[model samples]
Target: MAVRRIGLTGGIGSGKSTVAGLLVAQGAVLVDTDAIARSIALPGGIAMPALEAAFGPGVIDPAGGLDRAAMRQIVFADAGAKARLESILHPLIGAETQRQAAAAGEDAVVVFDVPLLVESGRWRAIVDRVLVVDATEETQLKRVIARSGWAPEAVKAVIAQQAPRRARRAAADAVIYNESLTLEELAQQVRGFWERWAKSSTR
Candidate 1:
């Protein structure tokens, strides 16, 4: 079968990562952009040269990798700096994403686990379906605090920056309501999707 490209997204505290893992276990090739970005920003990675050229050695650590903490602080404080960083990283990430997807072969179903799929405005045109993991804001805040030790305000800020739940739902071809499901229950939901996905792709 031809590859079914799925754009998966959710807010910070939603179980989107968990859902991605489930999909991977079901034989999906997961192309995670954030993971690719981190790998490329590591010492000697492809993005470092341009990144360093743009931001200078100040953003590079003693170990030669991008000083993620310093860079995070810089981007957080300056929107232009954030845009500059994105300008350096997005193309590299896009290239890598394409390479990985192509290499997944014709038979593999590729799930692009993009955190900002809805905000990007371009992903919708590429992917066959957008699967959004939905959760209430309160549920999101509590889950993030429990999992990451982030303060409530920090969680709130992260959620505030993401496309709203309504917008994400509007963009989704399917929605997985993840507010209160157990891991096993969520897996069941994913299993159902997998069954339908196989049949849908052949149509």
Candidate 2:
């Protein structure tokens, strides 16, 4: 088998990261875009210079890392700010992701865990398969609230910004309905997908 890629996406608090860990356990090379983005926003990170230049010093913390909460407020409230951010980070993320992908060698199952894959549309042409981990909106609300200690309204706001459940489903080659499954059940599902995936499954 040659190298293959699976584009993984889900709404916030939809267990996307959990599913990603499961896939990694199944021998997939994981290229987590969000993690890369976070790394680049850290102090002295790759994206910091441009982010500081674009958004100014107020968006940086005393520790010199990105003031994520402030930036989140800016991006969420201002569409132009969001686009400016994507412009600054996307190219760097893409280049680094590709560089990591190139290191996978032959026959590797590369999983790109992108939270915004459905919303972005750019990943559609690149991946062999798209897998969406899904849950009901209410379930998502509850899970995030439970885990993050964020205000329910804040969680809802984030959820509202992401592509809807139906939209994500439409983009998927396979879907994992994660509304109420235990971790073991989810892991079983990932293992099943791993065993069954092949070039023949391409659309």
Candidate 3:
């Protein structure tokens, strides 16, 4: 049976994770593409063989998992490198995302929590609705720096690599402005979003 799939997305530190959690509490089946990607790049995982074959040992950590830091540096510095890495991972991610969504069964309201949904171009066609968790670049920088201890330039680079804030908003069917809202307030908004887009749609 065809399911109602929601593409939930946001830039780094936009509090997308919190929205995802709240949606799960509202009973959405969350198929997190990033989590799937990370798992497949782990030691002895499906994507590891291809990653090793393509990028070689230097991109592999001593524990046999992907050296994400090295891979990020390579990808950011070269568009071709980014494309090469995505070519390897995107197919794997799509397949796993499908597998997980299928496993959710016929009645599930599946949310595809994809951070790179807008950048990917294909996700808009794949899901029923696109929901963006939005924050200003300044807020994103402050939050990520506080949480991850990444330098401002590092966060800026990451933000630059993603779809622009305006672009993300344009891609969205619904937008959650997450910059200054409290958790309970955010949860309240998510509840409203859930009632309208997810739970009601399932009916």
Candidate 4:
């Protein structure tokens, strides 16, 4: 049985991670792009040298790992800087994600949890289905601000970098409304999706 790869995405604070967790509990293999990105930016990771060259040594912590907060501020404040960082990191992350997915082997329904799936465009071709977790923009803003203690303006800035909710929804093959559901309810939805996916893919 070939693997069924699903791309899981949502705007910041839209509870995509929560949905990923639900899928994991249902026995899906999960690969998180953020985690892979962090791994690649760590001291001895393949992308660290390019990151250091692009951002200078100051972006590296005393412990030699990437100072994620410092790097975040730099990229978030400058569009060119963000693009440079992405240019360095994105390819590495994508390659590593594919490596991980392949290693998961056949028979696993692998879920690639990528925050910018719709924005990237490339991801659509790689995955069997795009599952978007969604919430109102107001809810997204409020949640990010509350959790991160970011100013409303900062939260909005992050939101601006993401594809609009309508665009994301339009691109999605499946949508999970995450704003009002309890974890139990979310788990049920994941289980239902899994059952259907399993039956269809096998046929």
Q: Which residue segments of model 2 deviate by more than 4 Å?
A: 1-3, 198-203
Q: Ranking under TM-score, best-scoring first? A: 3, 2, 4, 1
Query: What lDDT score belongs to each candidate, Candidate 1 first?
Result: 0.89, 0.90, 0.91, 0.87
> Root-mean-square deviation of each candidate, in angstroms?
2.2, 2.6, 1.8, 2.0
Residue 169, candidate 4: C-alpha displacement in angstroms? 0.2
| Best of the candidates, lDDT | 3
Off by over 4 Å in 4: 1-3, 199-203
User: What is the model-wide C-alpha lDDT for candidate 1?
Assistant: 0.89
Residue 45 in model 1: lDDT: 94
Per-residue lDDT tens digits for candidate 1, residues 1-203, read 34389899999889999999999988788999989999998989998899899988999999789998689668777889989998888999999999999999876789999999998899989988889999999999988999889778778867876899999999998999998899999999998888777445534
Off by over 4 Å in 1: 1-3, 199-203
Order of the predicted models by lDDT, top scorer first: 3, 2, 1, 4
Which is better, 2 or 3, measured by TM-score? 3
Candidate 4 lDDT over residue span 83-105, tens digit each: 99999999899888989999987
Candidate with best TM-score: 3
Task: Measure candidate 4: CA RMSD.
Answer: 2.0
Compared with the true structure, the alpha-carbon lDDT of candidate 2 equals 0.90
What ranges in model 3 sit over 4 Å off? 1-3
TM-score of 1: 0.91
lDDT string, candidate 3, 32-103, tens digits: 988999999999999999998888899999999999999988888999988889899999999999899999
